[model samples]
Target: MRSSVVQLAHARLLIVGGGAGGLGAASKFARKLPQNSVAIIEPSERHYYQPGFTFVGAGELRLADNQRNEEDLIPSKVKWYKNAAKRLVPENNSVILDNGDTLTYDYLVIACGIQPRFDLIKGAPEALQLEGSGVCSIYLPHLAEKTHREIQAFKSGNAIFTFPAGPIKCAGAPQKIMYLADEIFRKRGVRDAAKIDYYTSLPKIFGVEKYAQALDKVVKAKDITLHARTVLKEIRLNTKSAIFDVYNAEGKPSGETIESKFTLLHVAPVCRPIATVSECSSLVDAAGFVDVDPETLQSRKFTNVFAIGDTANTPNAKTAAAVSGQLGTLEVNLKAAMNGKPLGSKYDGYASCPLLVGGNKVILAEFTPKGPLETLPVNQAVPRSVSYLLKRYIMQPLYWHGLVKGYWNGPTTIRKILHFGRSN
Candidate 1:
């Protein structure tokens, strides 16, 4: 991009996002690398701990808890463009910003996060405008606070939560809100009056088997309707009804529109990587996610480019926890790659889904590429108050002090050492 040079060994690292993964990678790399080595390409002024918003919607957490000023989260050592990258010229190792500025880099970190598209659902294009309308989603941070208010005012009837038929950030978020609704209704003596329905296109409650089994029990015990393989087609705002195309066991169109009247509707909208990054089909996978090695966190095509968080095509469920783990791997591998050496870092596809079952209980689901990788020595499936307390109070401090500051990865090593410390 800068010249015909094969490498800038002195090259500046450019990042394309400002969210958890983007900022986390910049924080780690900027702190670890030499002076003026990293530049993050982000447009937003506020950084959000998106996972926390799920709890915020359920009224389990105050709406204010999910935010941090973007300036505060960024490390002072790196350059902050504070502009959206309009396009990626990866072959040239350059990016063009929406403000008509071109940035050239020796190595690039495509940390641009996924975008939720509510328009995929017919008639749902104007969903956000219906702020007080029955259609609401926890995925949008700005609506999370309103969702709490909407749920709190619910009297009775169908309280529906729908999961779109595609990859979404924080995969368990739809049901997390549903679980919160359950707790809220029960708390308000309205559980009996409301019928909680989890209408998802996914075949299971949670992707990982261990947590899915646990969630299955919770749904059954709570008497919530679990509709698997069901897809939402449209919503009639005037009539206050939803039209769903229900599929049969064969995953075919054994369907007709099933209209359900709703006192509340919660959805985790379908998502895709940002358009700037999406245009580079060479870097993306089938679902328009940047393709990367699950373990190494390196781009499959370009060695100099790596991605973390919701943008990457890695199999792990997108979460800030996963980004924390990937940051460790990417930092190690990036440093090694810079020296023309073999990759030293290995990301185990570590991801966690901290399912807030209720006000005081949580199911901490931690797993890696191989299989169920639990953090707690005891069962992580069953909801526990300890997990709840950690998620609510301790995790935030740990995130700001450790993860965002480039010290903590996932809880993998801590769990292993503590479990085997006395034995070994």
Candidate 2:
């Protein structure tokens, strides 16, 4: 085959992803800019509502129902390049595409999200796909369905779930599936036969103190074992055992290891920035996240570049709800930079995680970097069925029609209204 020729392209604004954050920004900016002035470089044809994967693992929702064609969600005026970003040349405000094309932009939005590293754990990738291997994950669609199967077929023995050491897309998902599986086992009359254990690298169940206190009660009430400061290092498939590296109070490896056999293993894999951005040393930090101003979402090195979602180095929970809160701040600051105005807007590091402790109960943990920023008048730390209903029924529609369409900017407004204008 003949080598393809490289062509140069230009856009007034360029977005480097087609996920939730990128798509939402495109929907808003396309209407504000000249027709076809904005471009999105995304290789995937299908887009998945990743937050729904947890419910899918619990057999509460189907994976297909949460997915849509990427083209369907893209704005009409925005140009979509069905290709991946090969290289980022920020010095020249350009990106090289996988198809031997180059795109230069006046302004750039980097929203390429994180990727799962199943290979980090020995035998995990293959084990997840093996028939009746008793191993599964909720991060991928196929693996999520397999998670349901594994949970359903679990008879008796050690059912182990793990949370990775580093930052993952959704920190709460690891325990969420475990809770759901607990309920399933109870309903199936296998609860007594099963020995459920949770191993997390974090010191506590959750980061926020308010919610962590609530989660502690939940684990105690359900009689589920919690192992803190433990990380899943490797999986032994032939023996169906897992090796964990234990960490002590000093936050270093304690030179201790735990090997446990499992009948069911649900893993939340370690996640990091996608290769395209992480490989660019100048554009990212030591931790492999885009080096951006945490409050303003603007690149520290390149003024015209900004980042959103899991790729950004902001100190917040990497969840879709965090993206919703960041959208307004990112839009305002990006517009300010374009117009040569002072960038005044700031992100409060607000993130929400609906902690599903059971099939019908949820604890809505909403907070900022400072502390809890609960929206409702009631105590959000308490598990409630109403919160579960909101997560189960209302959030999906609101995500598709509101957030994806660029209309929803999170619950800042609702919080104020519900708290009589006293809350953030």
Candidate 3:
């Protein structure tokens, strides 16, 4: 155990978590506010472009290519606190840091990202550690390369992928890897010997109707088995089998547990609100996420506090693209609150997912809570080589030079231009 004296610090604006949302929002405010007015609490030394992890698993990009030094990303004008938030005291506008320091802010931004709970599933943590155990997940940086290894080593038998219950950062990731693996299996001339299965807790293959309809066809064409309303319950590493609980369309368990053996398992483990956000009951909803108005991105209780990215309990899908969409709204609202003006800007719940189906083709799924909000004039539901090129070539640069640097505000302008100013 360690002991230290508690100290108090203050900032005009405080941001937590150095991930996509934190850096994106911080960069904008760091430039607008006075020097040292904006402060960020982040402990990690490396910042990862998590959206590229699917490509890493598919051997398209190395994990190193998707990572940058955390120090390099923080804006020069902002004060950097090499610390982690332990608790959020929103009522007092203060946050307790892991180093026994309390930071009080005039305005707060909770960008702490979601946490992947590997311990939730019995035997999962141990299974991932076992060498050649055939169990891997791309959610963690350390495990991503191992997932590629597992895919390369798999010659035959069942190749299983899973999507867990509740909201995950990228809802399509579990199956994205599955699609890429399917292409790899065919290329390696082992398609006939291998059996691919996708187990998801959702009632359908995808949430959005248009994308779901298209994905269903792709599943059928590829002869891939999809088990809907089903979730992984446990991993029997000794027997190389998994136990799953099946649910009905009504979202209730059917009291049926099925076990299947697999030669390769790619588990997208259950994700929940990180400890700092969840532990602060005042800041979170019943689901342990920062409870903010979906449109304004402002906290329901505290006017000076706001949330963005995966941490916010918004209706939009939790993706980096969603953060980019929310950035403008969050910035405007925070400024309005600071200046004592009514918040006029509203977020449309925009989010995008470049679903890499297979073989230089990607189904660019862009949507909100209502329906597909595609940027391009073409129907985004259909997989195309152009979409793949966008995901492969353009997205990474846009994320680094555009999004995190605070210049990219999503594809709203591009969408309107593509439609000749016909749409919003």
Candidate 4:
């Protein structure tokens, strides 16, 4: 145990979690505010491009390529408190740190990302640790590497992928890995011997209708088995089996179990808000996400506080692209509050997910609350090789250099220009 006085520090603005959203917010505020006015609370040494993990699992990119030292990416003017938030005291405008320090802020931004709960499923944590267990996941950095190894070693038997029953970051990721695995098996001349299955809790392959229709064709053409409304209940590592509880038409458990034996099992575990956000009952909704006005990104109760990225209770796909779109809204609202002005800007719940159908193809699904808000004028529902190239070459560099530096705010400008000033 450690002991120290609860030292207090004050900041003009405090941002939690130094992930994509936090870094973007920091860069924007650091340019406008005085030196040390903005403080970011993040304990991790390295910042990962979480969107790249699926590519790493597919053996297309190395794990190290997606990581950078946390300090290097943070703006020089902002203070970086090398600590994790333990509790959020919204009433006092203070945040308690694990190291016995209290930070009080005039304004707060909760960007703390989602936490993957492997422990939620019985035998999952232990099964993930077992050697040669054939259980792997791309959601975690370490497990992503393990998934690539499992793919390379697989010679036969079932290759199963799962999507849990909840709102998850990058909703397209569960099927992306399945398609990559299919391509890998075909290239290895073992496609016939191995059976590929995608088990998801959602009734549809994707949320957007246009993209879901296209994905349906891809699923059929690839001959991948689709199991809908099936939730993984447990993993039997010793027997290499995955047990699922089937759901009826009324969305209740059917009291029936489906067991599948696998040589490789990839799981996208259930995700929940981090402890700091979840435990703050007054600050969050019933789902443990920060309760904010969706369009304004402002807290309903505390006018000085806001949330962005996966932590915000917005009905948008929790992707890095969503964070990119949210940056502008959060910035405008926070600055408006500081200046005692009404917030004029509103976010349209924009989000994008470049669904990697295979190594060479991608369905660039971009949408807002209304419908598909594509950047290009062409029909984007169909999978194309150029989209895959864009995902590989364009997005990564833009995220590291432009977004973190506070320049990129999604492709809204490009979309407007391409569509002849059409808002949709």
TM-score each candidate.
0.93, 0.97, 0.97, 0.97
**Candidate lDDT values, in order:** 0.81, 0.91, 0.90, 0.90
lDDT of 3 at 381: 91
Residue 320 in candidate 4, Cα distance off native in Å: 0.3
The reply for model 2, stretches above 4 Å from the true place, is 1-8
TM-score of 1: 0.93
Q: What C-alpha root-mean-square deviation, in Å, does candidate 3 show against the real structure?
A: 2.7
Model 2 Cα lDDT, one tens digit per residue, 1-424: 1112223469889999999899988988998899878989888889999999999999989999899888889987888888899999999999999977889999999999999999999889889879799999999999999999999999999999999988898889998999999999999999999998999998998888999999999999888999999999888999999999999887678999999999999989999898899998999999899999999999999999999989999999999999998898988998899899989899999898998999599999898878899998999899999999999999999889888888889999998998888964
User: CA shift at 371, candidate 3, in angstroms?
Assistant: 0.9
Which stretch of 10 consecutive residues in model 2 shows the poorest summed lDDT? 1-10
Q: In candidate 3, what are the lDDT values of residues 1-424, reduced to their tens digit?
A: 1112223468999999889889988999988899878989888888999988998998888999999988888888877888889889998999988877789999999999898998999999999987699999989997888888888888999999999988787998998999999999999999899999999999899999999999999999999999989999899998999999999878878999989999999999878998889988887999899999999999999999999999999999999999999998988888899899999899999999899999799999999999989888899899999999999999999999999988888998888999999763
Give residue 115's lDDT in candidate 3 (0 to 100). 86
Please write out the lDDT profile of model 4 over residues 1-424, one tens digit for every residue: 1112223579999999899999999999999999889989999989998889999998999999999989898888888888899999999999999987889999999999898899998888898877578888889999888888888888999999999888787888988888999999999999999988888887877778899899999999999888988989899987889999998777668899899998999988989999889999999999999999999999999999999999999998899999998999988889999999999889998999999998598999999867788998888888999999999899999999988777788889988898899975
RMSD of 2: 2.7
* Prediction 3 TM-score vs. true: 0.97
Task: Give the number of colliding residue pairs in candidate 1.
Answer: 0
Candidate number that wins on lDDT, 1 or 3: 3
**Candidate 1 segments whose C-alpha is farther than 4 A from its true place:** 1-11, 248-255, 421-424
